[model samples]
Target chain A: MYGKGLRALTLATLVALTATFALVVFWAPNDADQGFIQKIFYVHVPVAIVTLVAYVVGGIFAFKQLRTDDRKWDVRSYVVIHIALIFNVVGLLTGAIWAKASWGHWWVWDEPTLVSFLIVFLLYATYQPLRFSIEDPERQARYASVFAVIAGAFVPLNFMAVRMASSLVHPRTFATAEGGLPGEMMFVFLVSLVAMSLLFWLLVKYEITQKNVTWQIRALRRRLLGDDAVAPIGRSAAPTIAPEAAKPLGQRPRVSYENSPEARSRGPEEIAT
Target chain B: MRSREPRPMRPTWVLLRKDLLLERRAPESVPAMVLFSITTFVLFHFGLGRDEVEGSLAAGVLLVTILFAAILGINRLFVSEQAEGGFDAVLLAPIDRTALFLSKAMALFLFLTLVELVAVPAFAILLLGPSPWDALGGLVVVLALVNGALALVGALVSALAIRTRSRDLIVPMIGLPLLVPALIAASRSCAPLLAEGGASWPAAKWLAVLALYDLVFGLLAYAVFDFLLED
Candidate 1:
């Protein structure tokens, strides 16, 4: 399952993302006003949008974990949050760099761009500590669900508060009545957004598969070492044959046989005879 | 061990009375809030170069200082509750949790408002002479809205503090950013009234935003208070 899906999705996302960037940088016209630096918008805006999308997905998984009490959803939510954090940091850094090039300053505290990034940073930073502080799995998931919902609610509120506080230091979508984006730019932007979303989904699937495989291996090892004769397939079965060479020093020797449980069920005297 | 009897409001009132009585005995929280307000007002006066025209700035400065000091007092109130194990007793009560939140919020609001009442007049006299009493109506509305918002946030933070490390530091870290919008709204609303004879519409709009924030968070905190207090 992981082999097929991971390869296909990763290849598809890479192709799409490369094409979108190529279109944005080479094919799209330079902004009438902001010139070459405005190209950063193609990356920054899409990343920002995807960051929000990732967070909402995380919150939905969190809610599902609460309702179903499923550990899968918890893993999904956890992985998605890490992905979201990556996108958030990238978006913030690129925005800062763009702001410096365009506005001649690295930071603008009053601007919505800076304020929204700060809020997202603070909200996601709380997730790790909140998770670590709790000892019980179910209780940790429950509290985290509540915190995720609260954080999700606050994100929009913080956005609105910053937007309402004052005029933007840089142009904002709301500043223009229709948020005038030329058709070509809008198309490329939409493609970039879709590509990022696909990439996020693929990464989440990869992490979940990795976790599932790791658990499977651990369970197999446990069964191989245990005395129980009930050999569960796919999980580790007790080594049917005890290898004389592999036995550790100072350990008891046991009868060695493979394929037939009958030979293993016999006494050591019968096997020696 | 159980007996059937009528349980009255006595427990909640007892809690409220205990809090008030403690305040009455110490007299420190309220006085400190008031003194903080005065000191801030004095600093503003000196910074504004003692110009009577600067009364508007004084109103904004005085109100913010009083609010910050009130937060200090609220943090102390919850810290004392944790220290004495009084919070557990309150949580064990049979009364509705909303009542507990409401009663505590009201008490803190009253205490903070009392400090504000003193601060307002002292601010007015020290900065600007007595003016039209009609503006007092607007002031009352702004104060009620801001104080309610503050108390609601304070209660939520207090609950968080009990469960987190560095209880003192975490409460303010979480609470202060949430308070910024309300502060901006209240200060803007009060500035025009204290400076000129009329209120600005923009200021009134900000006051409305403050009222909305108070209503939304107030309901949220009340609903979640029980979960927060659970063992």
Candidate 2:
């Protein structure tokens, strides 16, 4: 079920991303101020936006996990955050490239957007370690959700606080004091944003499907080959989908292997319960 | 037989009283925080190679010292609970889960305030170039708000880390990043008061930022805290 819409999402992401690149390269006009350097903005800002929104979305999923006590939601939340963290790294790197080209520095602390992203990144970077350190799977999921909720509320507030602390010396691309973005630039930016959002959605879908598939395979192995044939999952930072949630493959009628012909040769009481 | 249930806040008060009594008897977290703050001031004096600091430097040193000390206290806030199985006892009681959060936050707030009573004055004697009395009222207001933020974040982080392995490593790593905005607001607000020429009142905006941070996190920690208490 997780993979049902994944193909269409992947196609949409492919088309949108290709269109975004084509438009940015050939269609969008150069910025009057920064010229070619501002081109990086298309990739940087959109990725940043997606990363922040994805984090909040993860929080929403975490909230659902708590409300419903569903292991699947935890799996969804974890994947979303894990992918968003990758997107966050992309945003930071792109921002740095843009900064180096524009300001001649690899980083600029004066920019509240960049600085806020860094703080948010640092906070979330601990999520996995926090998850890994707890031994109980249920507690790990519960605690991770608690963390997600808190951190989700924090993202916007942290942005606001960082923005306030900075005296607005850094130039804002979207709403410059000069005025809002020009018409064509706005269009291009909007397109890029949509493309990035689609890509983020595609990645999340792919990751969730992968996790589900792996889990389903494991469940299938357990059901067909017997419990001894399957390995214990052991300690992990990733949230697990309960075998019950894995469905038909995992639900094949339990075979009493002990009653089978091979086991009959060995006798009933000889088998370990 | 019918039994009457206590008021919702009764458990909070009971837990608060217990924490206060424990601190009163042992005198552990507060004194340790106070000692750490003073020691950090000495280290800052030598590290910065400045006999006296003023303005932003003064604010930075003072707040950073207090923050690190607060982290030290946060690491221990839930230690007794973990060790003595206070969590199970609380879970068995017919009280709201948030009562434990409220009590723990309040206890941390009180401890932080007590540490400041000595630490802030010590900063004045040891490293502050300006007369703190000039901005005493404003400084108190700003520090109180900062303490509110720290206490809220500290209690939450402590609870989160309490059951984890290597909790000592976890508290600061998680707590510090979460606390940056509060520190930003606090240091900015206190910079004016700590200026060398003369102390002055903090800006309205910084105080507003601090208040907003407190409100948001306070509500957030409140809402999600019950989930953490679940077995």
Candidate 3:
């Protein structure tokens, strides 16, 4: 079931992204002024938008983790944050390149383009240490989840605060010729938005797959080696294997931890399977 | 059989009294705040040079100095609590979570305001010259609003800092940017007041913005305090 869903998502993303790129390059009208360089906007703006969406999705998953106490949501939140960081980095690079071409400077400190990206980068960068610092899984998830919500709230507020600063550093809003945009450019922009969202979804799915596989391998190892070798997983543990699978080749699986020296020292309660 | 019940308001008062009594005995926070404000004023007076008119700049300088000092004090407020392991006790108290937040914020606000009352007059006499009583009123309003906003936001950041490796660094990282609007509003409002002039539209607008900020973040801090205080 999961394999089929993955395949369908992959096919849809490939087709959508190809169409979007083609439309951006050929069909959309060039700036009556910026010429070829304006093409960067199609990529830069959509990616920035999707990056914000990814962070918000991460925040939502974080909230879910707190409410449901589910390890799955914690993993999902981590994957979304990872994808958001990647997209944010790409957005920053594309923005800097675009700024150099148009503004005649390699970096503009006051530009909303530069400042907002910096804030988002700093916010996500703090999440990793926050996750690792706590020893317990449930505690780590809870604290990180709260931090995510607070950081998510600050994102829009920071953008607004910077916008209100009394300086003519960056333009308030994007300008397209003819007041808004020509119809073709609008179509291209929408297509690009959809394409980027799909790409992010696929990336998140891949990362989550890798994470769950690693988790399952660890659990399997613990099962085979007996409870003595592996410390008990906390409240965030993956579900136990079904009873039919517990027999392990009809040899009466040696799950006992009583005889192991390490388990004996720690006490029986710590080793019970 | 009688059922045991929680004391509703007493825990909050106990926490508030504990902070106040500590201030009365040691008096470290208020004195340090005053000394810091004075030193900051002197530095700015010398740094900006006498050619710079002290009137408008004086208000901004005072506001910035007071906030910087208050941040120092607020950062230290939790230190003693943590050292004595009193924070967990407070968390384990029977009071509503919001009351704990409010009590801490209120105590800090009162202490900072007392320091400001002394510093503002000394600032006006030495640097900006004497002003009309109306300026004092405006200054009071500005300081109250600004200090409340700071305390509200600072409480949450302080809570976050406790869990982090670098508690000191994280407080400012989360705070300075958030404080910008309040800083601007306080400075603008006080500038006109120092001249004994009526509040201008721009000053009023800035004050309105400050009020809006306080309302939004005050509610936010209340809502999130539980999450932050969670074990």
Candidate 4:
């Protein structure tokens, strides 16, 4: 089911991204103020917007995970954050490139939006280490959910604060607020937004598909060669599924701590009850 | 069990009292935090090569110093819970888990206050070019709000990182960036107050930002703290 609509989504994203690139280079008019340097906005702004929105959506998924105690949501949330982190890197790189082109410098803290993005990227960069550090699968999922929820809430507040601080010193150039983009530019921007969003959805879907397959393959290997043939997955930052989820009904799923820290600290009696 | 439970504030008080008593008995976090701040101020003196700093320089130095100092306390915030049986005891108790969070934040606030009591005047003596006393009232308000932010954020980050192996590394990496908005609001609010032209009241809007940050993160830490304690 994870890969069900992946093909269609991938196709749609490909078309949209190609169309976007074509329009940006050949169709859209140059900005009166920024000239050709504004071309980067077509990709940079959309990627940034999609990255931020995807991160929030990841939080929402984390919330769902916490509410329902569903590891599926955790997997989904992890992928969303993973892919969004990549897009965020793209957003920052392209933004820097655009800044270098528009202004003389590579980084301009005066650009509050870019500054906020940097802060946000730095924050989310810790998510992996946070996840990787905790070895217990259940505890890892739960703690990661909590972090996603809190950091998700941080995005908008951070933007507002940094923006307020910067606006005092410089005029708002990136303020795509009212009367910002003209007609054709807005159209192109909308197209690019759609493209980036589709790309994000496609990436998340593909990641989930990969995860499900890996779990299923692990299950298959254990089934064919017996549990001893398969090694316990050592410490990993990636989310792992219940062994049973990877197998069909009526098959018994083995539960072993193997060399886990949880096994060492917890007495067998403590673990049983 | 819920009916027999002590009221929320009661446990909060007990926990706070326990932390204060522990600090008084052992003196682990606060003394280190104060020493850390004063040491950082000296480092800043040599690092920046300025005998005296004013305006933005003063604001930057003060905020950065207090921030790193707060990191020390945050790094050690949950050691007792993790090392001892405190986490299990609290989970076993009928009292809400949020009491732990509320009390820890309160304890952190008190420790920060203690640190500032000595560190702020020490900052005034060593590095501050402008007279800190000139803006004493405004500085107090800004520092209080900043303390609120640090307390909430520190408690939350401590919980998040407590179970991790790389805790010492995780504390500052997670806590400082998470503190940017509050940092922005605090630094901006303090820059004018610390100006040599004489201390002036900061823009209320910046204060509002700090308050909002504390309120939002306070509620957020409350909501999410339970998951960290789940067995």
Q: What DockQ values do the models have?
A: 0.17, 0.79, 0.29, 0.82
Candidate 2 lDDT over B42-99, as tens digits, reads 9999999999999999999999999999999999999899999999999998888899
Name the better of 1 and 4 by TM-score: 4
Which residues of candidate 1, in runs, are more than 4 Å off? A1-4, A53-82, A123-144, A168-179, A202-273, B1-18, B25-29, B39-60, B125-135, B196-202
lDDT of 2 by residue, A1-273 (tens): 447766778898899999999989898998887898788889999999999999999999999989977677888899999999999999999999988988899999888999999999999999999999998999999999999999998899899889988878787776776797888888989999999999988888778777767777787787889999989988888975452344443252335333457644642222210
lDDT of 1 by residue, B38-68 (tens): 8877887788776464345645676677677
Chain A TM-score (model 1): 0.78
Error of 1 at B91 (Å): 4.5
Model 4 stretches astray by more than 4 angstroms: A168-178, A242-245, A252-273, B1-6
Worst 10 residues of 4 chain A by lDDT: A264-273
| RMSD after Cα superposition, model 2 | 7.0
For residue B214, model 4's alpha carbon misses the true position, in angstroms, by 0.5
lDDT of every predicted structure (CA atoms): 0.68, 0.89, 0.71, 0.87
Best by TM-score: 2
Best by lDDT: 2
Q: After TM-score superposition, what is the CA distance of residue B92 in candidate 2 from its true location, in Å? A: 0.8
Worst 10 residues of 4 chain B by lDDT: B1-10
Candidate 3 lDDT for residue B6: 69
Two-way DockQ contest, 3 vs 4, winner: 4
Per-residue lDDT over A51-136 for candidate 4, one digit per residue giving the tens place of the 0 to 100 score: 88988998999999899785778888999999999999999999899888877789999887689999999999999999999888
Instruction: Give per-residue CA lDDT, model 3, range B71-100, as digits (tens).
Output: 787677677777887768877866677767
